[model samples]
Target chain A: MTDLTLTPVQTRQSHIGKAVLRWSLYILLGVFALFYLMPLFVMVTTSLKSLEEIRTGDLVALPREVTFEAWRTAWSSACTGIQCEGVRPFFWNSVLIAIPAVTLSTLLGAMNGYVIAQWRFRGANLIFSLMLFGCFIPFQVVLLPMARLLGMMGIAGTIPGLIFVHVIYGLGFTTLFFRNYYVSIPAELTKAAKVDGAGFFRIFWSIFLPLSLPIIVVTVIWQFTQIWNDFLFGVSFSQAGTQPVTVALNNIVNSTTGVKEYNVDMAAAIIAALPTLLVYVVAGKYFIRGLTAGSVKG
Target chain B: MTKWLEEHTPKLVLAPSFVAIMIFVYGFIAWTAWVSFTRSRLLPKYEIEGLIQYERLMASPRWETALNNLFVFGALFIIIAMVLGLLLAILLDQNIRTEGAIRTIYLYPMALSMIVTGTAWKWILNPGLGLEAMIRGWGFESFTFDWLVNPDMAIYTVVIAAIWQSSGFVMALFLAGLRSVDQEIIRAAQVDGIPTWRVYTAIIIPSMAPIFLSAFIVLSHLAIKSFDLVIALTGGGPGYATDLPATYMYAMAFSRGDIGQAASSAMIMMMVVFAIVVPYLYSELRSKDD
Candidate 1:
């Protein structure tokens, strides 16, 4: 403030410079935002167009006659095969699978994180390290064996099979999220709870759990997106009847010999992406915060 | 009794996740390793088949193509994402208005599944109905943008889509790092007549090295496991031009009914991942020791 008041010429020069910079920043950011949004913009426009317009390939043009038929078709009437049931049935299955998968995995992950970050039990660190290490292992390395094992358990191709897979993989990051968060939490809180004769579960349930809202939101959003959008596991672990929306979307999009239904494909993708996109828009700040804090402390 | 219960409480807390992960993840991975050496086809069979699967895998042109494609894809995806992410983060740090909306726009793609990403990008890049057609419609008949259909340039098209999808995540990481940097450093650099770009290039970027490495590792893992996008976009098409290792393994196992060969390909991928990850893990683990 003092420096600006003392230098009139410098202040005027600075004002002009600042004005130039502001508009330049706006223009630059506006351009990049379009780049960021191009695919989505194209998809939505195409989805509103008729099949003839899509095949004619004037993708950037405003539709001659915009229609919601593709959305209607993709949601309720498009064929996965001979069924023509669209993707509606699989939406509930996705919801059902996602709910429990998200719940159980997150609860267990929080508990594991609490125990790992707080308790110094023998071999606990080793187990936690191994679990974290598992985060790096790719799914391709486990698909065959998991198939065989799930077959042995008689759980292959079941919803339970998919839930079980989500929980297992979800542990890597969710537990890491909770664990790192718990580390950042002052140990005095836990120590005080223990001094009050609280057991492990009691302390976690009361003291730690209440303070864990941010991480819980993070895990829920992450797991929801992951399990909902998952394809390989959904396709591999489940039979045709039990597959999720991702598989149905794939089948709709990838029926090689049939004419590609660009409109319906775009609509279905928008449908598939809507849930997570909504979650992000509503809670994106905490999402970034959770990731930042979790990464730094972890 | 109290001592025994106290001793076992953490185990109880951890038991459910521990057992679930071991059985599903580690145990299944072990099974994958075992199957690679067997004569299984379309399913797992436990019989000693020596190294025949490995021999078959090595002989397959498709496997080689997938492996090379992963390298090309991985390198480009990481490099491009990092560069773009850092630049975006720096620009956004200029105290720009509408920062929230800008951030949301960048990160929205990360919210979508790769299936959606592939679908959306495929439409955008499709030679018949996408940018090429749109451009041609503008009266430039010679404007050729058919890389999605070209076997040679198909992989780069994948690279572009992937960079768009992932740079936001790297941006978030870099954004966090940039916010943490001391304002004093910027002031000092300005006092010394150092340009803002040079100061960022020389000082700020080096300071964000750890954040960069972590983002790099995460993206690299994603690149290795990239199947959904390939499935959605090209389907490894125009004659398997963009077939990545994970997709190749899926094809071998499910489409070709060669579980043994698939297992071999998966093991090779795991080995590649391990080679990259082990040293990284070692360093991360060692850092805490210091």
Candidate 2:
């Protein structure tokens, strides 16, 4: 490759230059990685420090005395509002919201994908386009009316209300994921099933569903991170008792009146971020695939 | 009956979702538009009025500030993120040994929520408690990095935090785009004795226009709906100096109880989104038809 780019007279100089370029590239990547990892490093060290150490020590220094008290307090006893019960309840609220929301949205997307891909009817493209538009609209556009609609349904400010909102808003991306995945699948399998007297549900249940594991993983991880990290819907729809972890983390970090415990705040931020971070670490390849699949094709 | 059910099963499976989106997504947009034209206060009112809320929105200084901040934040955030992301992608494309570790480190931030990003940056940028103090303690007694508190500079802190969180995801997108470019083209350019950088500049980057557009669309949308980051970091603070439309809308609706203002602000946001998105979608769908 180097010889292809360089003439014989320039070979030695070009080899030296290429080596220089290679090292420079590594240096550039190193600098960027440092910049990217700095905040997480600070958050971890700060969360581990005693409050006294945080107050007195250098911001970048390792904690002189490591402690897990802040994590414990953030999880069990930090006051966000009138309740001093910490983020425990809100964490559960997020779990409740995310589980059903991811499950329902993924299932609905699979079904929608199956129909749109295999059982194409007239106007299916139109319906898919309409749903695609749902992905782009700013959520602010629906806030007031959604609040009103939730009120009318008598589930406003509840965990169920938050779940419904996530599932509804999530349909676009989930459907897009499944539809794109299913479109790549050959149509012959479904057609063959039809000839064997298999109906829509049976063909989908036995064949498409089994074949959908990869896309389903992508969709579930995508939806799980999205719904779990959601703040707008969580903050807008749910109140004190049912607020999700993201909202609670915000309130805990931003609440004014008491002495600001930087350690506790850092711990709470890490706590709020842990689940998604874990998913990314364990399945980052799938996460990247999902992200690229969603954006690159659009 | 069997025949009818067979024919209808797919439609039956699709019906609930289609109806939900028709109402929850499209229907609510219409409702918000209607409410934006009304004189609603703490609660929504159905009575029709004519642009009164918009008139108020235009008159309010806070709304103006939010719009200006959005423009500044959006422009800087998008441009910087794309450039940095492209640079990182180009660097990673050099076939470095530590590419996987570095890529993972860069992309990890995107996995976490904006709220987490905001809080971490908030502490990092805090004048008395964070960077300033740390630098001062290192014997640079006169050093200061206090954008987190300065009213005029607070919005840029949001910009900084946003770029940090998103540039990695942008890199991932661009990296994928870069990798997909045919190796044969580079070989051809190499045979012509073109410099490596020039080959990339002239041939490679130009071919990734679609990826560039996709990144722009995603980043701009995230910027436009930037409520959580602002709320968690600055709370549009130093007297609303950092308010973007998203945070402004939330404040008006949830805190100030001015539902009319919220609705109008939201409509304006939606208009901004539509202006950027609809044209792109039109071109995309049109091209697909051919």
Candidate 3:
């Protein structure tokens, strides 16, 4: 009875304890942050150092002098095969493939999401469920058949074919995101629009589309990163001259018996990663907001 | 009429994507299934040999190697990825400083292609050039980290690299889940004198179960399909010790010119994935319905 009556005093003491506990959590988090950041530190330092320095195993040591020679070599003169040209040629190809693939996939995924969420259609659940199930199947299981189908269509080894492939595989996640997001929006909004004599296409284009910016950004960033970093389909579908930057990077980095250019490889990696990293930094808030929105809104 | 139109509109809207998927995706899956049944060579032939490809698949040394390696690698990859991912999420959820920086650093690997990241890990794990040599330089003359060269230990190395590459995505998924957990619950637990670890293990974990399961399924699927890392890191070498199903399928068709065998291997992989996926998916649907 006395303890219950003196609960305020107990609460004050607990507050102080909680404050201390929170500070300790901050400290613990700092340590983990260091662990996650260490590899990137090594990568950047190795990229800046000369091959001679790297070979001498001074990885953690500050470079004698920072140089961009490795970057220059990696971008221009590093040998992927008999040719001495670096990863430049593949950059354009990757961009070309990525842009169309990302745009088309996002558009289709948005439509899929809009329809499934807004319209109560027969077989909609089944189609959506099948797609979701398809997402679980390892893509490698389908690659052989996909390749054969492409060959039959005479688009095997073509960029369009590769784009089609990425879009198909990307559908599950994109549609999942959009559908969930659309679900979160009040059906009243669409109802009001319908009451005002708005049709499906108009409502989608004006109302739903504008409201979908966050998810669209999420879809774009996700798809861009995925298509840009994709190696298997790029390599499997396209040959040497038409290969993406990933394939070029692979050919350069994975070459056996060639002189190992550790500095060049690191530079190339950083270069390849630059676009997505930049996007993430620029849209850091949106990605998290988008994720939160998709969940909470739904 | 209105109800009929409402029901039919979604189907019409979804029809193009579905048809495209069926033709390009499921159609190919069926075609591959067919190829698996035939005794095709190189670029898939029409010669029917009934179950010969399956028998060959059952007997092939490489196929067995791939299957065994994938099982071991897949298990390790999923377990480690989930553990590390959950841990990172928990740590990040503490309202820490430099949250964005840490998240970005962890996620940067996923931004790079496997070719680049896998090759980097290969270099870092290489006995002569990486951690081993670095240790020797530090006066440990007896130091040896030659797992990359050892047939038995090679797959473990792949797991290490793969975990590094994938754990970040899991972390991202988990962090989102953790953030969404009700703060009121944590406050209540705190007021009740429950320890933070106890709260996490008891309240937080259960609440985050669905998202964690989703992340697990995603990571496991990624592990099962993992190909590029294996190719870039070991090339399935050191006597095929690091081979995975994807690489094995590719080798059979492209390298060995045995399309029938490759298709069979692919079919086997599908069956394995289907076995794991179908039941889980069914339960997921049922749960959603409820």
lDDT of 1 by residue, B82-112 (tens): 9999889999999887998899899889878
Ranking of all predicted structures according to DockQ, beginning with the best and ending with the worst: 2, 1, 3
Q: Write the residue-wise lDDT of candidate 3 on B1-290 in tens digits.
A: 98687546657778888887676567767777888888688667776769989998889888889999988999889998899889888888876667888787776566656776677777778887688888888999999999999998999989988887878778888888888899998999998879789999999989998787777666766777888889888889798999998899888766787878877888888888777667767886678769
Best by TM-score: 2
Clashing pairs in 2: none
Question: In candidate 3, how many Å is residue A169 off?
Answer: 2.6
Model 3 ranges off by over 4 Å: A1-31, A285-298, B1-12
Superposed by TM-score, candidate 3 places the C-alpha of residue A298 at a distance from the truth, in angstroms, of 5.9
Candidate 3's displacement at residue B188, Å, is 3.5
Of 2 and 3, the candidate ranking higher by TM-score: 2
> What stretches of model 2 exceed 4 Å from their correct place?
A1-13
Ranking according to lDDT, highest score first: 2, 1, 3
Q: Residue A216: error of model 3 in Å?
A: 0.7
